[model samples]
Target chain A: MKIKTDKIKKISKSSFTIYGMVIMAYVIMQILVSTGSLSSLMEGLLVPLCIYVILAVSLNLTVGILGELSLGHAGFMCVGAFTGAFFSVATVDLITIPLLRFGIAIILGALAAAVFGIILGIPVLRLRGDYLAIVTLAFGEIIKNFVNVIYIGTDKNGFHFSMKDAVALKLEEGGKVIINGAQGITGTPNDSTFTIGIILIIIILFVILNLVNSRAGRAIMAIRDNRIAAESIGINITKYKLMAFTISASMAGVAGVLYAHNLSTLTALPKNFGYNMSIMILVFVVLGGIGNVGGSIIAAVLLTLLPELLRGLNDYRMLIYAIVLIVMMIFNSSPKAIELREKYSLKRLFTKKTKGEDA
Target chain B: MALLDVKNLGISFGGLRAVDSFHIEVEKGQLYGLIGPNGAGKTTVFNMLTGVYQPGDGKITLDGNDITGKRTIDINRAGIARTFQNIRLFKELTVMDNVKVGLHEHYKYSTIAGILRLPSYYKKEKEMNEKALELLKVFDLDKEKDFLASNLPYGKQRKLEIARALATNPKLLLLDEPAAGMNPNETKELMDTIRFVRDEFDMTILLIEHDMKLVAGICEKLTVLNFGQVLAEGNTAEVLKNPQVITAYLGE
Candidate 1:
């Protein structure tokens, strides 16, 4: 007898569609770049675009799927960036192969960020709504300042750490300083390429999509939809919340690693890994349709490129950007638009048509 | 031994004793009713039993196991599952997915198996879907399985909540105000559904309701509370006729 596996099949089918879209977009962009039709600006934007996509998707796991507001997502990213970049820098002389070193760095970076995720999540997850958001916002600022005060140097005597000042380290002969307070990590190997970014995006998408379609994902969503109901139904709230939060943070760390390597010099600045950055990622999730993973990818890519593409507009760029955001928000959520969307949704396209037909 | 027993279950918010020294003992396959006027601590008792609120003083035993002050999820796993007074269906999820959430604990596969979509995960998920569908069919919600929970009609939403709770396979089901806002017809239907559920599952059921007809129709036993204290307890006919219970409902 043929057992009904319709849910699994449906999930796999939608997942395939998302995967196909990502790969198709990547292939088309690759072709354009290889054909020299894409401008250098657009070319440079590719890696950042991929990074933002990962950031948006990961943050969506918390903000959308988990239904918890968090503003410290970039703090996790900062952890990943600095730790991954540091690994790369420290091993630059030790490991000759860039690919292998970067692979190790990415894993280490994700682990570091996940650790921070757990630490912050345990205390902060206990808080709800605006309180959670505020605490996470504070956490981001704390990490930024904490990274600023931290100073690391290396020499034949081994690594030295000092928070007061870099000079207090008293390094041995030929000692090299990696992190200079405020100046951030400089002279790191720029090993991040668009291909690597695409690979990471695919990995992130694979994990997230599979997770969302899985049992744990449903439990997490159940918690999001109705915490009391979820609890009464025997779902372990803390376990699912922490699971999604840590995974979300780890993915953000992966993005951070990609972002760090992509840059010639990386810093834990407010503009780079701060409140504004966190808000931007949140905006991606919101504008994309909360809990809509595929929408997040599109939103991240489009939003990332919008400002760069509007460079010709100069002074009016941000004004136009704000207008577009307002327009998209209205279009995405307005009742009439939603009605139209549901009526013409892709699922409706495939199902047997019954509307407007007599039985 | 009773299938479920509660003694001295009490909680206070500041100076107010919301539920003071409340107690009930329910036998297997019995349909029990907890009735009280608004704010008489009927729902509060359900909250404590389900562990939403830790009773300042009380002991809850299920099948002779102490479950007092346990976390809500642990209490549920320990054979007590409940529904909210207000329907709490996962609004964004499909009706099928909502039921599957209740069946999550029953799936034996590891999370790694789920993420990787191992053969075991598919097998378990298929079983889960079939079981969820079967529960949905029981409530006549099978046809609407793919619809979002929020999109269901108000009456169906209430039914879906009960169906979802039942998916947890609890030995003792605690339903808070299941017939709260239903019309006469819907309430009548709900009464029948509750009866069918008890007979089919052979489970003990505890329900809080202001609907006197529903309470009197199905409950084999009744506990009436007023001012955070039990006003009367006996067979349904006897409790419903108690002077204090009548005064509490009709006022002095």
Candidate 2:
């Protein structure tokens, strides 16, 4: 019984460390914002920061944990964003309570993205390495283009969806066009709060951290480390891969929901949910340390806020950001850094000293 | 009846018969060895049995059930687990995590339970860790439980692989070159460990090895393959003494 508790304690210790850091950062920021110490620009960046953190963490589950290269994460996010925004708009009159409406929209959005995950994962997961990455990249572009031309409106009869022209959908009296082709969804309720975003991040961390330490997570990691050995040990590779991918997509969908609600109008522009967005999320996972969930959160928050914080640099903001990214990549992956990390790890710091000790 | 029966198992890669007309019948609790020179297609036979490769010619029966051409994971769940010729431990994971991966199918909690950290999740996770620790202790690897699998010494890594294979609770275990890169003393220890595993677990084991001394020390029965076909089969000493086996080991 003691051993059992000890085992559980070990798992929770790592989780608490990460969760603690995130909570501390959250509290400090909240205090700063409330005390009027933080600038308005920094205050406005909070929701975007949370959304990127969620994306980085979710993408890490695939790229870092599962050891698969996925470049369609923003595609899943777009699915969630459009679906969530559409739901909020269509039900704006029926759902008087903003929180309840936002809640249902997020859930529906996550379900829609998960469905897309399954649809894409069935064929895409079969490809390995660069092929998989390319296919997913293509998938993101496809989704962005598809949503750009989509038109949806609601009236007394019901919802009308048209692919080509918004004018083709002749509606009844008092009908409101929710989604105008190329113009995006208008009048989405801005129900997302800093508190709600924090709550969602906590939820995402809970789900992802628990999954990473679970039995299924082990199977998925085994598949990543060695597929043949995993299969020979009775791990169903396809099943576990699909499970991780779908859950990752759903989490990104949650981020999408947050993003949709935080804005009065949500667009599927190339600049918003495009290939670059996917690559940016991947950069967060890579720079944060792959498979390191806590690292991802820190990286996401810092990277998201870096540009705004560097407003004085103006033209050099992006240049500095690029240099910082390159330097971080080198420091994170170089052999010397790895050795240093091994020597000075938190585990070693807290534990007893053994032989081969060098300062 | 035989616990595992394979008859006329054959596979060809690009018209080259990697393994052909292979046949073996292993009874429960038997320690069987398959020996051959380099490129004798010994590993191919193991692959075929574990469903890594579909045998084009024959049927495999595991205790009266036909499992030919089934998926690899299904074959394992049907009571066969394997180690690799090249150690394939989850290198980045801790030794305990490497073993816990083998206990995957044993956990009964739902995905939702795992995500939510419900009581059942904690219960099963604890059980798995405890069980994994016990297996590590058997191989004397409990002290290194937290060490990364890739950081272990080569011999310990080999032992960890066997320990992990055993964690699957398999009725039939396939070990491919478990003693590769080991000194003679380590190989002897591995022989004793194999013997202990068989007697203690009461499980059948099929091993592919080139180490004649280790094979003679532990294996009761032996089969020699050459050019993807069986060269001889009998008692380990008798098969080792066969001219065909000797010639296969040496040049023409």
Candidate 3:
């Protein structure tokens, strides 16, 4: 019991440290903004940094913790982005308060993506390893391509969805097209702010961290390690796998909500919601160290900020990024490096402090 | 009634008869052994009893309820917990967490409750920690509760698997070669642990072991299988002395 409490203390302390670091970063950024010390490049990247961090964290749940490689993360993000943007656009006048509208939209985005998650997870999660990865890759592209041709308009009759161009909508006078196919939703309320994004980050962290230490989390990890042993112990394999996959998708949706509101035009672009984007988030999870929550946050922030930070060194930008990626991968995963990390872990400092008091 | 009664349990792997006409009756609080050569289908019978493979024919009764061909998870929930011949610990999970997973069916809390950290989550988790710690102590694994399951030594890993099995609070515990890789000292200690688990937990155990000494040491009843057929069944002393059983083991 005593040792268990110590373990609990260690886990909670790590969670607190992560929370503290994020808050510290938020304060530093706020100060930078107030003092006008931040460049335009950084100011533009603030909300995006939050978006990538959320994406990295959510993908880590699938790729890192759940032990499944998923390439459809950006697709779930796209689902959330479209649904949230559409909600905000449709209710522009109805919801005069931007905060209220965005909040509702975030919830709606999560639900929509969760539904899609269950739909995809049921059939696809049954296939393991590279097969699941391939299927999710296909899904990411399929969603992007399908949303590219989806044109939805709102008129007195009702919502009209068409695969053809906007002209096929045939809207009445004063009626407008909400989703202009590949062009995506426009006039979405610019409701996203750094504070909202940070708040969402904290909420997402709270949910995922708590889930990791819970009974359900144990069951999920057990399934990841050994399916037959897990089954022998009476864990419902399908239920927990779907739970992890669906939750991961919904969190990606929430990240999408933040992303959609930040942009003036939310489109299903190849750049934003494509195969490359999913793999980008996955890179963050992997290079961060799979299953390391704080590592994910750090990797995401550093990787996202690297290109812009090196804007002055245009020719050397990607060269520097690739080198940094290699360094991080080695530090996060190499056995010798792992040993070094453990040797100098923060727990050592904590234990030393306690030992001093004991002496 | 026997705590576990498997009658004529059999399974075929395509054209091959892996196990045929296998039967065992383990009364409450009994230590039973199923001994056979490597290819004698001992593990196959263990698999069928624990629902790892659906029996091609026969009935499995636990207490009084028929549990034949139930899903592995359902069989575990029905009071049958097992360990594998090859250790299948959740290698990544901490040792205590492995046992806590075994306590999953008994403890109740929704995933939402877990994510939200409701009071019930705290209450149930605390209960689980206490119970898991107790099980670990039984196998002298309490000190290593925080270590990863994969990091434990081979002998302790076997004991940890049994500890995990006992956490499910099952009526019957199945151990597959619990002493497979143990040295003599570890095996002797293991015999004590096995007997203690059976007595303390009031567990009815069925084990598959190639070690004749372990088979004769603790198991009160013995069943001998060779080429998918039971060659002998009776009290441990008599079964071990049976000419056919001796011939099967010695290949005479």
Highest DockQ among the candidates is held by which one?
2
For lDDT, candidate 2 versus 3, the one ahead is: 3
Q: Model 3 in CAPRI terms: which quality?
A: medium
> Residue-wise lDDT of candidate 1 within A78-135, one digit each (tens)?
9999999999998899999999999998999999999988987888776656677887
Query: How far in Å is the alpha carbon of B250 misplaced in model 1?
Result: 2.4
Candidate 3 chain A weakest lDDT stretch, 10 residues:
A350-359
TM-score of 1: 0.95
Residues B40-159, model 2: lDDT tens digits: 999999989999898888999998889999989899889888999999999877788899988888867988898887888878878888899889998999988877787788989999
Tell me which of candidates 1 and 2 scores higher on DockQ.
2
Per-model lDDT:
0.87, 0.86, 0.88
Q: Which ten residues in a row have the lowest lDDT in candidate 3 chain B?
A: B143-152
Comparing chain B with the reference, what is the TM-score for each candidate? Answer: 0.98, 0.97, 0.98
Task: Report the C-alpha lDDT of model 3 over A123-182, residue by residue, as the tens digit.
Answer: 877765666688888889999999989999988888888999999999988888999998
Find the 10 residues in a row with the least total lDDT in model 2 chain B. Answer: B143-152
- DockQ values of all predictions: 0.55, 0.57, 0.54
- TM-score: which is higher, 2 or 3? 2
lDDT of 2 by residue, A1-359 (tens): 23344445666777888788778988999999889999788888888999999999999999888888999899999999999999998888899999999999989989999999888888877665566688779989999999888888888898888987878778788888888988899899999988888889899999998888788887888889887788788887788898999999999999999999999988898777998799889888987888888878888887777777766776675577578789987897899987777667756311222224332
- Give the residue spans of candidate 2 off by over 4 A: A1-7, A312-322, A347-359
Order of candidates by DockQ, top first? 2, 1, 3
